[model samples]
Target chain A: MSRVGIRELAAELGMSISTVSRAMNARSDVSAATRERVTAAAERLGYRPNQSGRTLRRGATGTVALVIQTNTARTEMGETFYFNLCDGLQQTLATRSLDLVVLPVGASADRDRFLVNAVDRHLADAYIVSNTDRTDRRIEYLTQRAVPFVTLGRGGAADHAWLDLDFEGVAAHSVARLAGLGHERIALASDDRDINSTWEYACGYRRALAEHELPADGGWEIRVPDTPEGGTVLADRLLDMSPRPTAVVLAQETLAIGLYRRLREAGVEPGRDLAVVGFRKNPVCDYLVPSLTSFEVSLVDYGRRLGEIVIGLLTASPDDEPVHEVWEMTVVPGESDAHPPCEKAAG
Target chain B: MSRVGIRELAAELGMSISTVSRAMNARSDVSAATRERVTAAAERLGYRPNQSGRTLRRGATGTVALVIQTNTARTEMGETFYFNLCDGLQQTLATRSLDLVVLPVGASADRDRFLVNAVDRHLADAYIVSNTDRTDRRIEYLTQRAVPFVTLGRGGAADHAWLDLDFEGVAAHSVARLAGLGHERIALASDDRDINSTWEYACGYRRALAEHELPADGGWEIRVPDTPEGGTVLADRLLDMSPRPTAVVLAQETLAIGLYRRLREAGVEPGRDLAVVGFRKNPVCDYLVPSLTSFEVSLVDYGRRLGEIVIGLLTASPDDEPVHEVWEMTVVPGESDAHPPCEKAAG
Candidate 1:
């Protein structure tokens, strides 16, 4: 955008090009007074180095590759969450002239050959991992190559730079909200993506039970695929329980939606027969006979934070501390959870 | 993905490389029979022209850039319709081995420069328009240069391939649906960005009303921005009408959401006091106090169709006829529409 070079800036300021270059690169040889003069001249001239040449000279391209795995069925790739995060990421990266390469990163075919061939081959400065599991080959390869990278959710360990939603708080809040309505029996339709998000949220549910001094029932956890069909299957299985869950806290909206359809087919009223809550208050949830109560995460903000981290990683020295960002979730209460166990409520 | 060469195929088929090359290029000297034989062998051997040499030779890369405009306030980029359209576009183009260069075409500094300048400099073969309007300069400049282009939606009278949604069908359906529910008086909320869609739909609405023997009333069309606050303003204006509309159809989900909120605050239930329907259903719409009924369009399919057209144009002769495509919209019924007025049912 700035179409001016350092030589033009130096010429305008009556300063030697070498002195200006050193100031721009932050060299110690130039005195502070001269550095200020050089900086001001560069700023006034609106100088921007040729991006391609600068990136080539430097070791990285200052661009990050967002590798969304589309090999196996991925929850993030197929859902609204993926787009919102990318949208948020664009908001953050577009400002810094950084571009996101949205390529299917899975090695399902020759794409895998491209990913493992070389990080430098892709000309990316850093890698951003999404929809990957605890032992993903892509993350393992990136770490081995010593390339800067960030993950949306935890990838194996907490050592890498990441920004994750508060999975625990969501479970805790659901429990509190349901208990306040005098509901004793609660169940969870946990997401089956990476064990990380599901495990964390399940762990949080246990923690909340301990904090509230409530019993942790074995009937609560149902590990199901992160699709509406999977939720329907889980719902069928739950109905076989000695005392079916009075309230359900499904980890994703697709599950909640599937549950609604299955329940309707079974001639059951949602708000009256069962109370439900889920993550990702998906927009379609409210259109169900009884809407779902769920938590809303800002994917745009998440992507923006990821962008900031990538930009920071791109411009900062290799030794600069990695940036870590964490955003919480907001609860969106819907009609599905508006009823109590004793009597269904009407507004 | 095949990465096989024509020369390699020629060697395997025991044919002269020059003859094979001539056949592949469709040279007039090569007989039709020979050309068919050569093409069959090439397909069998999975021979694709070397992209590097082709890119250098024609000054055109077999890549179409999709420039999506990102505004600060527009965060619902993950809307279901966009994903579906993009998916559709990708699916159609994948067969041709053409790549879609996805980038956020936003304003840098105060000036909005189309990244067309970036693509025009031998970066891509064509430009695929996404989320562009009638006053777009991209259409004008690209047309002057005679570049192969396609649009998801039309902008003015540009000579390019395009695939647009049937807004007229959407409008007709909304009216017919309301009429089936016995709604006589109605109002409409139209989004500013979706003028073309609004225009077609409005005409359809009028046509449908005339067919139903319902008279059009003045002060029934409410202009609104695509936001919750805009919905609020439109709702206020519509509610204050001398003979208030029993139903409303909106061009945007945010506006419909605002209307639902406004009605709730004024102690009016959505289905009881005002029936509502919207286009461009956002993720948060289902959770709105009354889930919105609306039209659904697939953005992924739209993107895919545009991609396919670009590939077709690029691979064909220079005088190839531009391809025209239009995707249909289906109704997504929610809780907004009520049967025979909720007050009458209550009585």
Candidate 2:
């Protein structure tokens, strides 16, 4: 069935196209009586305004593009993160009658090329860039084009609106918690990716160690793949250490599950033999023999904050400063790090 | 900076709007030399055709929407399922220059209302509706309107294209596997949702029981929420059974995690005390104390098949048959169902 266009609706109502358009748009210039008649007639005739036509006239797509990384080695965590975040984003965007369009860029695809096409095609009024890296060319391109965009994570781009999780704060707190528990040689398992959060996490780990007057053991700050398999690799590395670190902080909490499994297989028990702190408390952490000590991030609320900031950036004038903020993560204590270092490990 | 418009490009090249438009569109009427010159100048001036304008002219949105449910109680599994499926969908759609837009419907929202709005707004050239119910109003509405759409799961819609997983086959296979091991009393834990798969699973379980000459015990069939917490609730219910079931099959594998935890806490080891079979093997199943016996679904390949079917539907003539297919699931052997009923329970 073909949609009834504005021309047909106007012809049926015996009214001018401009009047029908204005009435449909709910413009104040159209008299209330005429607006009601036009609305009734349009409804009766099933005449919904075409999005493309309306978008061309208004210079607004009534859409926001959320660019995310997909087809990566690890997908569950990232997909879950965005899925929850999208709920909040959708709820918030609904208030303004804007649709959220997710543009999933394959891991192997050229990220900047995808962004360029989206921009050139005017796919959305604004864009939300996720899985950010330290030197992001996408952010740079958006910045140069003066397009409205907000990054889910901050990068090296200059003076743009961004909302990032408090990875640094979580790292510092986890280090302090372990240090106060008499853990001197605390290890840090950071993601090998050049993600901004990884860098922040490493920085916080180093700063906390310095504050504790502990030697910066290069071997303790090993970067590995941010996956369950990588967690097994990390466990192997820890076992290879002559005097293993008493405690470890994992930047990617996903690694905790594999770490626990591998450690147990090696006759080492988490919370009893070694202390572990991870980011993101989830099902795996909850079901682990000894619950994992991890940080809890309310992704829905974070998504809402992102939506608010995106709206702010879109509506704000040029003189208004671009917002930059961090979302705090709360620590959910578990049995994974219940004890201090074992006596034999003091050496 | 403002985007360079077609009018400005035409003015700069001293050509008519028609000539420039035809050249940019690569019309055969335009000489190759002129087409090349127009393309070079357009590129140099950064004059890309507006998507809205092009869509209005061509009457094709060049977008395919994948609608999925979100914000439900059992989110991890659903999110993971769609996330993996989307990768294949996107990869296949990319071949035809069609962008996949994910429209996540909130669990609490009116689903029909969402679909109506999406349809009214002409959101995409086609849609892939997922989480199908037995009598889906959205499918009915889409079918009535003659909208181009394909469901991810089969529904009650008439003569429509659909691709569904073989839930019936999986259920039958699981029942036979346990029944073959000399288990007379078997239980089936099905999802409480009104989804079509749940109905098929229940049917298969009942049919299998009849074929094996075992009583179709009403008490053995229970419908529960499809979440880990639901799994805990299911465990409690099973423990309360007067003559507990010897083996069980779970329609949703997510419930297996919590069931394992609760059962272990109750001093009833899964594989030793009672046999368990689950659907969709994953990390939890792999890491379970006794690996879960579950079906392996290659979601990416399933997604690719869906993409192929959708494209077929879109390009096929009216006289052509509407495609309907069921994807087969493979069983992954595990230790969860390593034995039959214990000797003491034989009575």
The numbered model that scores best in TM-score is 2
Scored against the native two-chain complex, candidate 1 gets a DockQ of: 0.11
lDDT of 1 by residue, A98-215 (tens): 5555644322235444456436444356777776466666666777877777877775666767767777778889888888887777787787666577777887788877777766
Q: What is the C-alpha RMSD of each candidate to the true structure, in Å?
A: 12.9, 16.8
| lDDT by residue (tens digit), candidate 1, B74-158 | 3332233443444545555555555444555433322125454444344456767666565667677677787766776765674
- Model 2 segments beyond 4 Å from truth? A1-59, A76-78, A345-347, B1-59, B76-78, B343-347
Q: Report DockQ per prediction, comma-separated.
A: 0.11, 0.23
Task: Give candidate 2's iRMS in Å, 1 decimal.
Answer: 2.8
TM-scores for chain A, candidates in order? 0.75, 0.81
lDDT of 2 by residue, A1-347 (tens): 44465567888999865567557657565699999999999889876543222222113577888998776545654235777788778766776677777888764468888889878877788999988899999988998898889999888654788878888888999999999898888999978989898998988899999888877799998788877788899998987897888889999877887888898888888887889999777654566768888887766666766776666656655565676776667799999888988857424
Give the Å error, residue A266, model 1.
8.4
C-alpha TM-score for every candidate: 0.66, 0.82
Query: How does model 1 score by TM-score?
Result: 0.66
Error of 2 at B131 (Å): 0.8
